[model samples]
Target chain A: MIRSGGLRLDGVTVLLADGSKFTRKLVAQMLAEFGVGTILEAEDGETALDALKRGPVDLLICDTLVENPDGITLTRMIRHDNGATYRSIPVLLLAGHTRQADVIRMRDCGASLILAKPVAPKALYDRLAWIARDPRPFVDSAIYAGPDRRHNVGEPPNGVARRQMDRERFADQTKSSVSHDEIMAILRQADSL
Target chain B: MRKSRFAALATRDGGRKRSDAVQAAESQLATMEGDYIAEADRLIAQLNVLSGAAQPDVEAIYRVAATLRGLGGAFGYVLVSDIAGSLCDLAERLGAAGQVDPPALLAHAQSLSLLHHRRVKGTGGDGEAQLCEGLARLVARWPAATLP
Candidate 1:
C-alpha cells in the first residue's frame, strides 16, 4: 500500500534466494543502496522457506534455478502451502534465459514479476517501485493462484493490439458512431455544398 | 480473488527518493566491478583446470559457467556473459547425453580465459566475435537435449 505521494524503500526487509553467493552479494548491495532495512540471504529454497517461517519479509527475490525446490516451486509453495502470513508477500523471480516452457511455468508459479538476469539498477528500482504501487489483487482459484496476470488496467487505446481477439474487439469497440442529428446535419451540409 | 494490499502496506512507511536510490545502487555497482572481475578471473581459472582434467567434469564446468553468466553482464562484461551462457548450454546438452565433447568444452573454457585476460568488456571486437561465432557453430552442431 504505497501512499499517494510515494513509498520509500527504507525499512523494507527483503529475502533474496539464489544458489550463487556472488549473486546474493550483488543483489544485497543493490537492496542496501535502496535503503532497505534488512536483507536476508538464502542459498537454496529450503533456506528461503526457513527464513520465511522465521519472520515476515517485505519481498522475496529468487533466482529461477535456486536449489532444493527451485524458485518456481518455491513461489508455488508460498502461494499455496506456506503459512497464511507468508503467502501474499510479493515474489520476484530472476532468470538467465526464459524458454517458452519456462515462461508458462513461471507464470503459473505465482511470482509477482520475473526479471531477467543481469538486471540493471534502474530496472530493479523500477520493479520495486511498481511492486510498491501495484494494484493487482491476489487470486486464489482452483488451478491458479498469485497476483492477477493482467498487468494493464484495460486494453491499450489506439496501441498495437496484443492478440488477434483483442484487435477485433478493439476495432469493434472503437468503431466510430454518429447520432441521427449529426448524420442529418452532415447530409444537409453536403446538399448545401 | 482479492487484492492483497500487502505490498503497499509494507512499503507505506519510509524510504529515500527513487532517483537517489538508483544512483546509489549504480555507484555501488561501479565500486564492486573490480571485485566481480577478480572473482570472474578466479572462476575462469577453475574452469580451465576442470576442463583440462582426464574426465573433464562437464557438470563442474556448467556450475562455474553458470556463475559467470549470472554476474558477467551486470559488471559490463557481456562477452563473458554470452560465452558463459553458451558454455552452460553446451555442458547441459553433453551431460544429458551422458557424453563429453572435450574439444567443444575446452574451446569455451579457453575463450572465457582469453576474454578475461584481455579484459574484454561489453561484447569484444572482431576477433572475439569470430571466437563467439565458432563456439555458436560448435554448440549448434550438438543437438540440445529434448525438454520434458
Candidate 2:
C-alpha cells in the first residue's frame, strides 16, 4: 500500500514481544528486511515493559500469549501509564482469529491494530502504512482507552438503507457540534501535510 | 514512437532489481520451514500428551491450537493455518464449556494432525479444500452458545 506521502519505517525502533523463539526470530528477521533500524525481542510482557522504559520505541509487535503478563495486559498497562515516556507507543497485536468477545477486549486494551497471524510481510507493511496515514486520535473513556474505535462508520456500504426518519433521529442524537477553532485546526493540519 | 534505448535498459534493470528483492525476501522466509517443522512437532507432541490425559488441559490445548493458528499463515501455509484456526475455535468452545468431550477434541486434533502430518503446502495444495471442508463441518457444529 504505497501512498502519496512517504511512510518510511526505515529508522524506527521496534519491539517484538512473543514467547516462542522461532516466532520472535522470524518477526525480527522480517522487520529487518523491511529496513527497521533497531529490533528488540522480549519473551514476556514484563520484559516488554522493561524494554519500553529503557528505550525509545516506535512500535510494539506483541503476541497475545506472552507470559508474566499477556499482551492485552501489557497494552492496558501501557495505556494506563500516565506521564511515562513509553505510554504512547503504538501496539500491534499478533493473534489468531479472535472470538467476538475477545475482539472487543483487545480493542479496549489499546491495540493500535490487530494483525492476524501467519504474518505476511506485505500485510504487515500495509498496516504500518495505515498507522502512519490514519491519524486516529486516542479515546479515553471509563471503559476503554486507546485508538478511537469510531474511526470507521459502523455500517457496511451497499447495505439496505435505513428509514429516513430513523436516520434523521440517529443523526440528531449522536452528532457533536464542532467549534470553529477545532475545524480550523484540522484544516491547518491537512494544509501543512 | 521512438523509445530511447537508454530508457528501455533502465526499465529492464529496475524491474529486475525489484523482482530480485522479492525473491530474496521469499527465499529468506523459505528458510524457516525447518524451524516450523521443529516447533510444530514439539507442539503436536504437547497436544498428544494432553490428549492422553483422562481430562486434557483445555486452556493448554487451546493455546497450542491458537499458536499454531498464528504461525501457519505467516509461513505461507494457509490451509494448515485454516485447519488450525478451526481447531482453535473448537478448543475455545470446549474450554468455556468446562468439560472435555474427548471424541470431539480428538477430531480437531486429528484434523491438525492431518495438516502437519501430511505436509499440506502453505498456499494450500493437494486436497486442502477437501480437508478443510471436513473440519469446517466440525467447527460449525457447535452452536454459538458454547462461547464464553
Candidate 3:
C-alpha cells in the first residue's frame, strides 16, 4: 500500500559516479537532501563496478564522461557482463551535452534515464520518481541487453522509426509523456509477438 | 525489468513534500555558489595556462571546457556555459585531427577570462550573446563529420 506524501528515498542506496569531485559533491548533496539513505561515490567506471560488487546498490547515477570505461561503457558492461542483480538496476546517466550523437550512444548503451548536466532538483526529482515507478521490462538479447529501449521516458530516435506515416500519427504524443502502464502494455504485446 | 528495489522503498508512504525537498536541495546549491565560483576561476586559469603552452592539450581543454559548461549553467552563468560549450566543440574537432591551434584555444580562454573577471552572469547583455554566437560560428567551421 503506497501512500504518497512525497518521494521517500530514505532507504535507497545510490552509487554516484563522476570524474569531477565537485560534480559528485553537488549531486550527492542533492541526493542527501532527498533523504537517500546511502550514497556511494566512485570517481571512475572500475571503482563504480567495485562499489556495486561490494554490496547492494539501489540506483546508479553516473556521468556520461566519467573516465576509464566511461558511463556508456559502464552501463553496457552492467547490462551484458555483470550478474543478473547488477544488470537490471536502474541507471541514470548524466551528460554534459545532449547532442544527437551523445544521446544515441547513451540510448544504445542501456541507460534507464539520461539527464543533462547541471541537473536541477525538480528535473532530478521527476526522473527519480519515474524510476521509482518504472515498469519497463529487462530486455535480454544478443545486440542489446537492459531495459527495453523501445519503451523509455526521455528517449531519442535511435534510427528505428517506422517511416513517415507512423511518426506523423503519433507526433502529438510526446515521447516523455507516455504513461508507465501504456508502455508496459506495449512491451507485453511486443513480447507476445 | 522487474520493479527496482529502489521503487519499493521510494514509493513508500511518509516522505517530505516535493517542494520542500526541492527547496532544501536548491538551498544547498546556493550555499555552494561561492565554491563554484572559486572552482570556475581555477578552471579558467588552468585553461589560460593550457592555452599558453607550446602544445596545448586539446583533450584537456575540452575536458575543462566541458566542466565549465556543466558548472556555469547551474549557477546562472549562462554565457560561461554557452562559450565553454563552443570551446568543447572546437577542441573535440581539433583533437580528433591531432592539431593544436593556440589562437583558437586562446580565444576561448580569453572569453572565459573576460566573463569571470567582470563576474558576468546569466547570458550577460546582447554583446555577450553576440560574442557567444561568434564563438559558435567558429566551432561550426569544423563540422563533426569533417573531423571524424
Candidate 4:
C-alpha cells in the first residue's frame, strides 16, 4: 500500500485493479483528492490476489475487463476466499457499457456496488459513502457469497414491491443532491455495521 | 478521532475545492481525447478489414471500444463515449449472435471518426446531431443495451 498524509480513506487501504496505466494513475489521483491514501495498484487479477495475501484492504475499485481472472471472476474468487477480510471488504465495479447479462452476473457474483464508466467523483463518493455507512450483511449460499442484494432496509414489509420503491428513490435522488444529514447518517452508521 | 477526522475531511470537501477538483479532472480528460480517438480508429480499421465470411475479432474490438468509451467519457467527451459505447454494445451483441456484418461494422467505425473530427472542430450541433441520428438508425438495426 502507498501510504501518505492523514486523510479520510487514508486509514482505509484500497486496491485498484485496472489494466490501463493511465486509468489507474488517474483513478489514484481522484482517490487521493478524496482523502484516500495507501492505494495498492494492480494491473490484473493475479496481482490483486497477490496483494491480498500481504494484508487487508478496505475497498476494491476494479474494472470489468481486467485481465487474468477478469473483474467478475476476481470478485467471485475474493467472495469465495476463506480469508475473512477478503470476503468482506467492499467492491465497486466499473464498466463502460453494462449489459443485462453482465448485471445479472455481477449480482450473482455478489459485488457490493456497480458504477458506469466516466464515473463523476461525486457519484463515486456517494456510493463509497453508502458502502461505509451501511455495510450490508453478506449472503452465502450454494453460489452467492458477497454483500446481501436485499437493500430495502427501511421498507416496511407491506405488500408494496421493493423494486418500485427503489426505482422511485433512484429517480428522486438523481434530480437533487443527497442532503448533508443523509451523507453523515451514512457515515455514522458505518460503525454499527 | 480518526472517524471524526474522516468525516470532517468529507464535509470540508463540499466547497470550491470540490468543484475545482472536478474541473481539474475534466481538464485532464480533455488532454487525452486525441489518444482515445486514435485508438478507436485503429480498432475500427481492424473491425472493417474483416470479411463477412470470417469471424470478426469480437474480444479485441470490444476491448478497444470499451477503452475508448471509458476514457472518452472520463476526459469529458460524452459524444465519443456514447458513440463508442454504442459500438461496444453492438460488438457484444454481434459476438453473441455469432455473426459479423462488415458493412454495419464499418458504418459505426466511420461514425466515431467523423464524430471525433467534428468534436475537435467544435461543430457539435446539428451536423453532429445528424451523425448520431445515423448511428441511432444503425443501432436500431442491431441489438443495443439501453436503446431508446
Q: Give the Cα lDDT of each candidate.
A: 0.74, 0.64, 0.76, 0.61
Please identify which of the two predictions, 2 or 4, would achieve the higher DockQ against the true structure: 4
Model 4: interface root-mean-square deviation in Å: 16.2
DockQ of each: 0.13, 0.07, 0.19, 0.10
Better of 1 and 4 by lDDT: 1
lDDT tens digits, residue span B1-148, model 3: 3478888898888977888998899889889989989999999999999977998888788888887888876766666777888888888778656677676677678778877776665545545655565566556656563411
lDDT by residue for model 1 over B30-118, one digit each (tens)? 89988998889889999888877878898788877877887877777777888898988888887777887776777788778766776
lDDT of 4 by residue, B1-148 (tens): 0222223333332232434554555455456556656655665565446423265676677777776677655544556677777777767777766766555555666656655554432224444555555556654665544321
* Candidate 3 regions with alpha-carbon error over 4 angstroms: A82-84, A98-103, A152-193, B146-148
lDDT of 4 by residue, A128-155 (tens): 6555544356677777887777756442
TM-score of 1: 0.80
Pairs clashing within candidate 4: B29-B75
Enumerate residue pairs that collide in model 2.
A118-B73, A118-B74, A119-B74, B76-B122, B77-B122
> In candidate 3, which residue pairs get closer than 3 Å at backbone N, Cα or C atoms, i.e. clash?
A137-B1, A138-B1
Evaluation by DockQ, superior candidate among 3 and 4: 3
Per-candidate TM-scores read 0.80, 0.75, 0.84, 0.72
lDDT string, candidate 1, A124-168, tens digits: 776776766666777888888888887564421211221222223
Who wins the lDDT comparison? 3
What ranges in model 2 sit over 4 Å off?
Answer: A1-7, A152-193, B1-24, B122-130, B145-148
- What does TM-score give for chain A of every model? 0.75, 0.73, 0.75, 0.72
Better of 1 and 2 by TM-score: 1
